[model samples]
Target: MTDVENVAEDVSLEGFNPFDPATQQCPHQYYAKMRETTPVFQVPGTDIYMVTRHDLVVPILRDTATFSSNFSTAGMSPDKELVEKMKEIMAEGWPPVPTMLTIDPPHHTRFRGTVATYFTPKTMATLREPVTEIVNRLIDELPADGEVFDAVTQLNVPVPIEAIATVLNVPVDMMADFKRWSDDFIAPIGSNPSDERRLEALRGTVEFQHYFAEQLERRRVEPIGDLMSDLVQSRIEADPGDAEKGLDVDDEGKRELTMSEMLSIVSQLLVAGNETTTKALTEGVRLLAEHPDTWAKLRADPAGYAPTVVEEVLRLSTPTQGMFRVVTADTEIDGVPVPKGARLVVMFAAANRDPEVFPDPDAFDPDREGLMKKHLAFGKGIHFCLGAPLSRLEMTIVFEQLGRRLESITLADDNEFMYFPSFMLRGLTGLNVSITRAA
Candidate 1:
């Protein structure tokens, strides 16, 4: 289909609105227009600058010194009252502080180093069997032949949280509570930002702080063989530079992370571990269901072809569409000058389909040549997603088993698929599908 023909009959390129029903249902046409014209353009009604083209986005992702990952620069309130309440929870421990997600180096370098070893490909490789088991357990719960279900709630949402809860050594009984916390934690800043949403997010943050503070205390007394225990016992060896700053340390001169400090790391993991992957899995299923040809190819050789399928789904679906970066100094993107302290919205979804980089960018082709060229789905540079390996693992395993079990799958209705309203996230609200089991 030609670019203009791809757009819904009523929606015009000049009138594009991401939140609009037509655009959300089909965003590729709009992204294509943005790439073809204003690669570095401002949103129609917002000051946020969007970097659409692959060339423009790669530079922003790479130039960490000029573009920071800190979201605080976006000018959201810190909520002083919440800080005061958390002080009691933190006590001698440091209160929730900047984590790898929100901090820029050299502090980002120091903080990421604390947990980087645990996320390496080698460490993540151990999760294959457990993740597969989780996928199978969820699949077993599916109804007997010719039944329908909301895949998002039944599978996509719960499976990832189970994997995350297991990793954190959080009890199975607390799965519901963890899901609640995860929902409330990230809800505040999605598509429709509001006071009510902010309040909900704060409540979740406080509740999470209390629960994890207790967990850290338990791990201190009894070092369980889990990620949480490793974090509780780990300490930062005081450097000579620390002595210059007159910081206190133990006899060995190493400082352990405080309860609140550990909370920051744990919370980021809890949210990152589940949320994006859940959405990605949902979209992956939708993609396969919509394109039977691709589905057939994947099922034929899941073990060999599943990885490539996962990459294509990630590129097209792009769980986290974009993230805010603070410009440190004056810079020009595609020759358009941007001032210092400006908030640049780096659009990963836009770049993933850039025609220059991916031939036939609009189509979903897992066999597309040069498939190994890294896509920004997990991002790039030092701030690249630590959970990328685990996310890919979860999607691949879920589909690998799914391809084997299902003879066919298709959407249950003709209604437009609904998406979560968020400035940064791209996900389905529900995906009802009919399944036909294999004999």
Candidate 2:
């Protein structure tokens, strides 16, 4: 047996709880074992199956018909009391509806289509100047050379939130609330919070919905050229055709989005637009701080190497680690039978580290062969991340700017390097770094 297989064999899967805080801290060993022995692993005492191998993950992601993205059917039962309380709170605002992430093809296509134009590579490229300005401004605010600063709060968090705010034409002054709302949106899925905490988050969600509803109304009456205006003005075909056809918005079935649908889409855009990107930025800094040699290489040629660094960081960090998918029909992943109604944790982070695909997968190697297209960090198939282009652009620019401005980035003496407690999301809670300004 190879060394990886040997290592995999040493780690037992018995009583392995993916949701455990310990597992969340360092899941790589468990993932390695799963990938090698049981690529389709069922979390003990649960109906959820985690798909680990890259080859298996790709097919599962592609076969959206069999593996549905509609997570409502995933058998996740939250606290009844909490649900009732949240429903009561949510009643004050627009009804919550499934938009991009939750719904399947035809509906997903419709929701994704309306805003797709704004996130395309060309459109994202247009924001390069503003994004660069945001990055530099944040860097300027960092403490003087050789001082310890919390990169997570000072730089990583603000950069993406501000950039996304710029895109959505939302006021950056409301950034704290924006971050809180974003956290609330993913609270149930990402952080397995307490009933009280969950209720608090729901209240925040209601506030978010109300705030965006007003924004949508303003955009409707007077269409500004921002993303919100585009979303408000854009019409979709009334008859959302089959998934295969993919978003056929002809004049025949043209209609504006309902208030609920508009709210849902905007909520998704806000949460997804900033949250994952924030995590990616945090992870990138952590990775750089850990590997001075890699940082040195990146500093040597910021423009040429920043993109590669971004991909490597994405591959290794994998901010949005795993996305939940439900089995529509009875299916078998790599001969492991998964019953209908079973929930599948499509492990993108694990897949990125699959040795069969990405050799020496754990190492931060920007020069890895086929590094650009191989990593599933942005995910694969139709339900791929909509904000991927924007995320990439932000990372590329931030890293380049860091490379130019900072002489060296080293972990602070007091750095704990702890990640946020989330089974689905992997991001450092904070990263304290000491930097020397480049001459």
lDDT of 2 by residue, 1-439 (tens): 2111224447899999866777777778888988888999998888889999998888888988998888873223677776788789889888877888888888789889888988887888789999999999989989988888898889888888998898888999999999999988777775567788777988898899889989989998999887788887877767645233454455566767778888898888788788888898888887787788989988999989999999988998888888889898887878989999999998998998988888888777888888778888888989889989989999999999999988989888886667677878777788888889888
Off by over 4 Å in 2: 1-9, 73-76, 239-251
Question: Candidate 1, residues 1-439: lDDT per residue as tens digits?
Answer: 3211243334346755554544554566666777787777776665567788988898888898899887673324446785565455445444457768888877677667777776778877888888889999988898766677889889998888998887787886787788788777677443544555655666667888889889888988998867878887777766576656555677887877656668889888888888899899988898898888989987798788888899998988888888789888998888888888877888888888887887766677888766556578988888888878788888898888888888888888753577776647778888888788777
Predictions in order: lDDT:
0.77, 0.83
Clashes of each: 2, 1
RMSD of every prediction: 3.7, 3.9
Name the Cα RMSD for model 2. Answer: 3.9
Report the poorest 10 consecutive residues by lDDT, candidate 2: 1-10
Per-residue lDDT of 359 in model 2: 81
